[model samples]
Target: MTEEPPIAVLTDDTAYAEAVQLAVDSAAAYYADGTSTLDDDAYDRLARGIQAYEEAHPEAVLATSPTGKVAGGAVVGDVPHTVPMLSLDNVFGAEQLADWATSLERRLGRPVAAWSVEPKLDGLAISARYRHGRLTQLVTRGDGTAGEDVSHAIGTIVGLPARLAEPVTIELRGEVLMTTEQFEVACLKRQAHDGTTFANPRSAAAGTLRAQDRPYVCELTFFGYGALPYPDDASEQAASLRELPHSEIMTWVAAQGVQTTAATPVAGIVAETLVQVQERIEQIATVRPELPFNIDGIVIKCDLAADQSQAGFGSRAPRWAIAYKLPATEKITKLIGVEWNTGRTGIIAPRAVLEPVELDGSIVTYATLHNASDIARRGLMLGDSVTVYKAGDVIPRVEAPVVHLRTGDERPIEIPQVCPSCGDGIDSSQERWRCVRGRSCRAIASITYATGRDQLDIEGLATSRIEQMLDAGLISDFADLFYLTREQVLGLERMGETSTNNLLAAIERTKAQPLSRVFCALGVRGTGRSMSRRIARHFGSMDAIRAADAEAIQAVEGIGPEKAPVVVAELVELAPLIDKLVAAGVTMTEPGWRPPAVPGIDVDPDAQTAPEAGGTSELPLAGMSVVVTGSMSGALEALTRNQMNELIERAGGKSSSSVSKKTSLLVAGENAGSKRAKAESLDVRIVGPEEFADLVGALL
Candidate 1:
């Protein structure tokens, strides 16, 4: 066995200074390129090493060193900054933090007596400019000189205020981030769209904010760190600003309804020595794991404004402040192999099979590769050591492979040419490879969809049971599910006699499901429960629907010419399956179902859709599309929005979820928001909840 040579430690003062400068330049370049060469842990260690070198030989510290300036530079920023949003210098642990405190005292030539400590949030830095209490402009931190203008995108951020609590012109700097739950949802959506999933919450937040297309929906939030044009405290007269604390200023910011670390309950510690500050940092570290969002470290600032000013400013960061970064929740493990799984939508997603490593208190064995593009982007290869990190503490993601550690035996990842589950050809039209068989090949998903509440309404059929049935070959298609005898169901792994009886009863009950439901269960392209209802009403039966041509199908509202052919093709392909469903004694026609004048209503034309006895024979709401929003008040508080829609449908009307040009009527209630405004803009007729209830009462 050969031993690796020791890494040369820099002892020469000049050489140490040059090494620090090189590290800073590399970090800045990496930031500008939207990629990072160093992990958080490695960066912190580098930063600490630089600090140590400077402390050991104070005369050798360079004013223009990377350690003196902010780490990231924004060359692409368009909006000129009014006040530079400087980055903080980082320290790793308690010892480094103490050294930083001692350095600060030595620089100021005074004993540091107070500090304001807060979480160093792992997110994108943003400056929000407000004018007279109204949010005006928002920008990203671009090299502390100029920032990218993202005013158009600010409204999409969930926790950011559109209008201030008090109308005052001010510039507030904060970190923009998505909560772990939000990141998970965003990843799901991105993967569904064949887009790359973000590596972490911070990355996701940054990418979402910088997206050129404005008004995109995302659950991004902001937490104010500081504000420009500091608030005036006329009541107190201080000695050279020394008496004024930064904690108090932040308190004022929070009082104005701006979210800050105060909401996070970031403790303000007044420490005369470095030991006390270390204790405070340790306290924060112990509780950081339970926080809602990602926070990489703790930030300690000179509490007294006078002391902060006395310490002065660096080329890129404040001299009085330092960030104490926590140990990174990352690990390097061997990329043992890769496993492919098919999503319900037929997307073939890759999962990395890893040699188990403990990270952030959990043993992680697998991580999502997202897609082939992501795998390629990371240059992942089998039998190579890979870096893995958890995004939002929930999803494990493969960051990259350690190419330097790779042996010659490592193999390049090859995307599967066929679906791993069903052995069907892969559809490569999109970045995400999908199964050519689509929904049919996904037996569990097809059965689950068929038995959903809005479809065939088959009770006692859970997803696990569906998978079991498919595994046992008791069900090859949705129709085969109906033909499962009690004996066959009893043969399932977990099935008991009572469970089998319930399963048989549930399947038998589905035979009476209306033809519209059968159509929905068929899983035709460009068709759902509502579309199925429209088709059933238009053709009166399944046979008529099958016989209808594309032009005839196009007549249904929402089913246009392009979608009409898709519907026909899907139905034709399902002919044999449909025949089997008919043979299983499932309902082929809706006995008393009549076409509502408008689409999407499960209403009888005779106005008998609602439980109420009588209906207006005139059907005054016929052919009208109605939308309901907000909470109902007064007499109609007992009725839900769905009930109201049903009442409208029974009156020969259609109920829509969104207010569009097609919406002829809008039943608005208390606290109606954007929907009411949209309805008014579209010239939609507006009625109060009481009036709507009265109208329904009159019809009934």
Candidate 2:
């Protein structure tokens, strides 16, 4: 398991004191009014720093320190709680979790019989009191021991019904949160109401839950974690419910018309062993990005009532429960500027230049802004504080601008009127801005992609060399590469005699590449190297492919109704380039692929075998839907992902990019993170790269 960066320790007394004050202030603002300058991760780090400093010098500890207290002892409420809504201690990794579990067993004088694991939703913790099955009051977990009444938000919350299924008096403790969809709607509503947006879902939920007298209302969701007898109720049913195991209590809570984790993908699961508990934690982490609501960690608690009683409670939390913290996926950062870059297809995309912020273990200095319209929609501006979100290997995106944190110095983003790559007119007709020159404006990029190892496999034609050639007017499109003479290549700045010879030789070799590689080099909008391979193999010849209409193209394995037309249009648009390549003596037919039989044509049986003739069935990986992830090693180390997809197809397997129930196998190599976990959760067969290499050794 990969470990996250450790929290910074405050060695200086002055720095420690300042950190403590900052944490206290932030906590006070957050608990009092659901607003804070710092995000959860930033505050956690500051609190941990203060705690580390205090551990070394207890005498210097501030009285208002956030450590060892719920809500950091910053909030006071008029309404007192019958049972404290305590915070859970957190474990950053498996080792800490194991140590905590061992300590719990030691305290209990026995191994726990069962453990319940559930997502620790990133939301405001609250207790909802019901009398005779009717919701009476909603209280925020303001200092744990006491809370503020938020009954005004009772009717606006989903999953917490006004009346229960049965007439029972109970106090249900759970989290109040806004789902991703709800958060978006709330942001729109807030923007409409006052032109300000909440930073993230958690803060949005917090503000929405406590807000009153607003013209618009934002709905929130509740998920019950614990159920207990109401302070005024002495019913036998309520008493028995309190004595039941935590898992059963949650089930009972759900049965009584209150929502629990039962409906979500990361539902509360009962595990008998620590290993099982960790597995469940991994499973939840794998699906965390896909969950509608945000969860900061997984909560593991001893399931049995006896275990809970024996372990008892600590100063701030239960001894039997701990939160297995996942790495934070969001951070607030300053949008320094925006960069407009042209893609191969001439889509001018806007990228956010950010103040360096560590997110999900990476230093993210840049995030996707999407397009000009998205920038306007998000109301993003230079010098604005923006909430950047990232999950797993997905690219970071600027979710929204932190409107409240903006200064008057911030300026509106400048949308480019001309192509950034070339001084051409801009096509602002679609949501995505494009260069009027289209692919021609980004010729160098497209040519470089064409010479990539999986495409034309042209060696010695690095991006620098391609750019030099382009600037020298020796090549415009990739098709011009074959036309370059030895003298023409030698005219470039860095082209020595031997280097020129190698460059020319590399370009000459590309002329003999099969139709698949040549098609991949075309860089069609909807087709990648794998899709190009499928198209080339299905048609066998370039003429057959170009002659095929969109309906005919859809017969290929992965080509669909939407994508088929795009492929056809791209091919038609590239006709001049294709003719140039044909004229340059490039191979136009796939090496091993057999084209479909033509109707009413007398064919030579020995000339070419038809696809229906059982050629693929003999291959080792026939009929398999394979997904490859992470870095490969040994014999497969030199291969790019496109080459790997080529090998999978060569061995008669369909290569897929994502893992799902349909994924027949996963070739998970070193450091295969979420995909590997997801595959395990789905019970998909997995093999290491070396093992996979052996299976496809002949093809390799």
Candidate 3:
């Protein structure tokens, strides 16, 4: 696919005609075949250019131009709509959104009473008609005035029930789309039937909705956005619904067993002022990346029926509503090559090297392919144009190849026959290929992780120095570092007398680290810093952990049956290294760890009694779930995330990675983003890092 052209002002008739043609063609392909060369962002720019040209030269506008038509005048149907399925005008940023709000108030001749904000779901728009509380037909939004019949897809769509809770005739307007999980399932089913992979979720939903008589089926999801009285129905209830506010109408829709935006993070909400609406928009945008579905923009509509009626409608859209668009997260880029890099666990992961493309707000040059199987599933090839997606803080990934735009010059991706790091044979027993050498193949990665701040925390052991030691044969594994001599360190390059002594001292300190850090430094497959701490505390000693079987290991707080076996096997494999560390005088037991009480064991009367179930504990933050976000300051300025977690544990609180309803408190520092917004939305208590520092000051 070609890169999107820059948006330009149409200064002459030639430029104007070209822009109009591009817009019409792109829209036609999108509506008719569920595929388009231009993405939503590019198409919107082209359409905006056409609108600007027509505004400046109204007398010279052509009759066939796509200025004031739904679906860009590219789609037609025989089924007429009761009310025009109008499209929404777009605003790019806060200033434009504010200007639109001001214009709406100006047109209404008064300040608006209220506003409703919702997510603008990226999907196809359809009208579902219900007769006497039963779904009878589904129609696509073709040219707004009329639409194509798609009622044949009734049973396959989720959220659009065949029977309603009430026996009333009405028309429901909503978007039909596939969620992230649903889209993946659909792709696998389509590929099983020898169909080409879908370019994106929006197109997959579009194709699945219109499909007929296929041997397989792909599920679709729906969320109602509007409700109106059926053209043929003259019921009193229908008339009364039209008089109600937009927010109340949506609530009624949800009560009738129809799915609305009530369950989503960006649920429809009523705001009494423009400031509240803007804040809601910002909140939605902040959590956009974490949502399970795709949303291109936030829709802001006047809530009061009286306000909507007074504002009236334009030729294309209602003046009462506008869409505030966000920057596009998906962009077309060329797959230049593939690079296979072995992970710390010896799994060979494939990464896609792409032509630099601007996605979201940054330039992306690489994307994750997950593994060799993922590349095969996507049918990706070198030199092919691919859709790369990047959200906030999410690693960029290759969605799929644009098969329609592929040329014969594209070549098949080559899978590596040997391990990239160790030049050894690959074990292909599982879907993800691994090296026969296992952790031995990735010595550098494993060693570096073992010495990280959250693990053993051996100071002055940077990756470069570790590599130098390995090159000189002074260290074969992390356990060997504790046995190095001063003469051996001084033999390496840049190792002066004082530097050697400091490095030796750092290595000496690691010998006294508790068993929890030592086990964490072992680089077990199924265990991380947190799990390592849990395991060491539960078993109390490394010998007991190694002696425990899979069944006994399952008793650890987070370990399950499947994971328990994996941890047991990894510990067995690392037995030799563990014995070496023990001989080197490393601490074998966790500090302050105690064995759990047995059911019938005799206990010492002098020992401290356990806290009662409903009683408060002595710890300041006992039983609380705490989340820390953003940058810390003041007394907590220098604490790392792992150190913060340690502090939370010391204060008897459970450190959580995310903020949800279960979260008791959030430590929000400067520039906190999505987690802070979610905490506020869920009504979870929030405080600054300084306050958090004070709360846990005793433990510190």
**Which stretches in model 1 have alpha-carbon errors above 4 Å?**
1-34, 45-67, 74-78, 107-110, 214-216, 230-243, 265-276, 331-336, 339-387, 390-700
Question: Candidate 3 on 1-700: residue-level lDDT in tens?
Answer: 0123346588899899888777787788788656787777777778788887888998878877877776635787789888999898888887788889998888888898989999999999999999889999999998999988999899988899999899878899999999999999989998898756889998899888888877888999999998899766667887789789999999999998999989987898999988888788878887788788999988999998999988999998999999888888898889999999998878888999999987877789999998888888889999999989988788999999988888799999999999998899998887778898888898889999998888889888899999999898888789999899989999989999999999899989988887888999998887987788778767878989999999999998889988998898788889999999999999998765556668999767344333222123667788899999999999888889888886776576778888766899999999888789888887899999888878877667
Candidate 1 global TM-score:
0.48
In Å, residue 183's CA in model 3 sits off its true spot by 1.4
Task: List TM-scores for all candidates, in order.
Answer: 0.48, 0.84, 0.93
Clashes of each: 4, 0, 0
Give the least accurate 10-residue stretch of model 3, judged by summed lDDT. 607-616
Could you tell me the lDDT of residue 242 within candidate 3?
A: 79
Local distance difference test scores for all models? 0.73, 0.87, 0.86
Q: Enumerate residue pairs that collide in model 2.
A: none
Candidate 3 yields a Cα-based lDDT of: 0.86
Candidate with maximal lDDT: 2
Model 2's alpha-carbon lDDT is 0.87
lDDT of 2 at 297: 93
78-161 in candidate 2: lDDT tens per residue?
788988889998888899999999999999899999999999998988999888889999988988898889999978999999
